[model samples]
Target: MRVVAIVLLGVHLAYAGTHSLKYFYTGVSRGIDFPEFTAVGLVDEGQFMYFDSNTMKAVPKTEWIRQNEGEDYWDREKQKLIGSHQAFKYNIQIAMERFNQSKGVHTVQMMYGCEWDDQTGETNGFRQYGYDGEDFLSLDLREMRWISPVPQGIITVLKWSYNRAELEGRKHYLNTVCIEWLKKYVEYGKSSLKKTVSPQVSLLQKDPSSPVTCHATGFYPSGVTIIWMKNGQEHHEDVDLGELLPNEDGTFQKSSTIRVTPEEWKKNKFSCVVEHQDKTVTEKEIRKNNASDDSSSQRSIFWQWIWHLKLDITVG
Candidate 1:
């Protein structure tokens, strides 16, 4: 039997030379509530963004992962490569090989985000986990930008309208994303646009031992906070938060980094919080222990990376 992947739907923005992307995850659930998993992504231009429910967090690759995972993110993350979000190890290596052969350069971005549906007759949305992975799907955007906080509500519209001059109005780009899926704004045809925004929190952790170095992964177009909390206290020393990486689609990702000590990490509670639009939200807590330590003790196995398809832009 052949497995069909969910298609990412996108629409052209009028007057604006851009597009937005959303992916529907299709997989066999066998009728069971699943676990919660978040997606993380990165780009060739060093852009990063991610969405967990309605919270989108954008930041530089190095710092975000570091903060959330503490010292173990790097090690445990490698183990996760075999699970939901497979690293570009295989695909990126292939792209590099092709570029090596042609002596040319091309750019691509990586993204990881979590999904869920609340069908428990209780909550509002949907989310759950199953198998080694669940209904969540991993995606890649070659040239398209993932515009806006992955739009909210039932009715979402992206239109590129020409700059209409009201006699002498300011030269506006004339773009909007209408979120009509909610109760207050549900409309079949004529509805106003909801100003959508996504923010991110870039977390970084330095070596508890010595010379602290930071490296990480991320998605694009997010608005949030990037701070180091020691024992739940905001520690703002030796930290460098970077600017947001704007997506070709319009949204952006923010980031930052810092180095501390094992003595610093063992203090109490450490966390990175991302508060963005969409009524969406996400967060991560750093434990003195790392996921890699668990994997090592369990003697886990992993799969290699590979790219079976090439992503190209399409238009109607």
Candidate 2:
């Protein structure tokens, strides 16, 4: 993820909470063939109902898409979307070839999101695209600068897309086509969406000499914080924070690790505190007694164990 300022129509914008608009194309592409695209839209971190050419349905259907008569219907717009999807489906291969690797699953994601003041609707933020899960290009919209390097041809096309005339045209389309879709998405879908699903937390010490790792999985709306705690206080030293990644089920997972000496591990109880969007907190503890080390054996062996913790928040 990259952070940048947002500027539109020669006006400067202030930074605020992240608001994102993303179009993602993901599929496997082998050899010279165009990759099959599974395109979807995301706002903030939640899925918004969008046309999937493969499914021909508003995919990953939320309650709003499922209920609300004719609200999720977008058959007439599918043809227009397909053209954009195909451009990326073919262009992802071009990007791979340019990098000299063209075999495997390819993903192209275009994102327009920024931290902008809601009252003023101003932002100093970024417009970016990634290829195969890696950053390929980025534009600092506020500074009118290309934040990442791109080939000459690609940059030329990007410049044209950002040109004033094209931008005005896009703004019109967005007001009519995008904003309306977003209004429906937020009004009907967003509030009802799950903010946090209790994480499946695990403690693993695979090797006797390696660090103890606490892994969390099956969470939603990925702004999760995983921290190691010594006793009841936060422990930050020697701790490594891992990247939050998506799961096959469209949920999220992450992990954190901390190095502990054998004596320290035996003497102190270590805990992992997970904080999520819902204000529901969970703590998973790894104690010397709970750790799967066979006391009968001369050699110490630590086994992996999983603990599920849940906390419910009640709003008064």
Candidate 3:
């Protein structure tokens, strides 16, 4: 009940060298209306598998995974998630007792992942736990030890630290098994993962007194740059850059706003430039808001604009 949604943003690498595989497991206490336990698996920031107590099954979220993995694979994943779900239920109770909390919503979460840099042949692994939106414990892979940020987690750290076999098994999985699986998934979805789509850049202005916003959406790979130029030179003052956000279809959207008075804008040539992958969009290529646009299309764009603005405020 009252599930804690964890949004993990992948590091946008300038080069296509780094790739990651991550898993998030969330367990909530009883007396809530939602599922007690839910798990998600992501490869390169794209969700590929999901499981929940209500479904009692692990399902593939991507066509590539469904095509590449057989029923046996889903069965194994389902069994593992079921076991984890039971453990999370018990752990949530224990955590409540430790915190002297009862009869209220509480959450136990685990996030573990591995990252590989193919070009440099570098690899890293991490495993961390959280309770009630705060860090509870984490594993130091290099030192092969558990660490707790809160006093309530000390007991768990002590108990898990003594399990040498489990620690070793976890280390093996993170360093070896996890990396192997990540590589396989990358190969399976290489076509979709590696493809790129150019963005549709637009210049939006609500009114003469409002800031001019450069909006770019429907870009692939989630990496793009937006900038404002004044009189053929890059202008940074009074500019706000928005965070990259995912569209409903898995592409990305970003915005950059420049504050310039109407007089200054009219006196000088101001431009918005967007760069993505190998393409560069200049002001000459941007679509401007116009009255000729259909009302329905304009309404859709207005809502999207408002949505992004709200998201930017929330994320800030």
Candidate 4:
């Protein structure tokens, strides 16, 4: 009997892009309350995000293992780190081979972009995309259905990876083990704001540097807005916004710089304002003594305060 896979009710537009990618891999592990998985992405091999069941957020693998996991954790779980990294490389190789069977067309880049929805629990899926954003394969775990066509080779690989016995074992794990874990993880992730720290904003200009930069550091939750103002007027042009980088402690930092002549800088009141969780706003002003262009100032501009004002979150 020829049986066709179920067609999803809704129409999905094929994302446009070609994949010049050669490899991608996803590794899943059992956790107490939440499962920890790492996907060695096609875009950046060996560079991927790690989500700990305890943390309930994706962190840099190195930072998570070294700082968060601690020495005791490593000592207790011997070979876990080495095994995980080795498996990561091995999976990318598998992904590379699978990529060849995807379309047989011109494919150079591979993509691995998948996300899980802890809120609904069942709403999780994985997708492989081309460079133009077109999907190669997509799976909807909620329905246990494929959103796109599943090639015969891919199905064969999946079956070979997990036969009837393994499939039943997976069901047992998902039903029994994952239920409690998902609930706790969702709760922890929501209450994470209780441990929030307001950002430390600094306006700095080093020796031999003409640009004054505003640096915001040590804030939880990556959503932050930074702006440069001159004499209380916001200036948009000539502002360079840096990427939100992760700290060793899982907090985030970002910077914005603007070029200003020494004369213009001295004449104008320059300030940088940052907004983070719960409308917490921190603003800092930049000033230098006229004695030398490189001297740093000690005058505090503004004490950090929380404003309930609704403001647009402009993260660039």
Q: Tell me the deviation in Å of residue 60 in model 3.
A: 1.1
lDDT of 4 by residue, 79-185 (tens): 44344435443443444465463332221122223222433434222323221123333333354433333352355335433455644554454454444433332
What Cα-based lDDT does every candidate model obtain? 0.28, 0.51, 0.73, 0.41
Screening candidate 3 with a backbone cut-off below 3 angstroms (N, C-alpha, C), the clashing residue pairs are none
Across residues 54-139, which tens digit of lDDT does each residue of candidate 2 receive?
A: 55444434555456536335554466567756666567666667667746654555555333333565434434555554555655
Off by over 4 Å in 1: 1-222, 247-250, 278-316
Evaluation by TM-score, superior candidate among 1 and 3: 3
Note the clash tally of each candidate. Answer: 62, 6, 0, 13
Model 1: how far residue 41 lies from native, Å: 24
Question: TM-scores across all candidates?
Answer: 0.26, 0.62, 0.70, 0.41
Local distance difference test, candidate 1: 0.28
Over the stretch 81-177, how does candidate 3's per-residue lDDT look in tens digits?
9998888888887888888988798777778889888789798988878777667788898988888877887887888888899889999999999
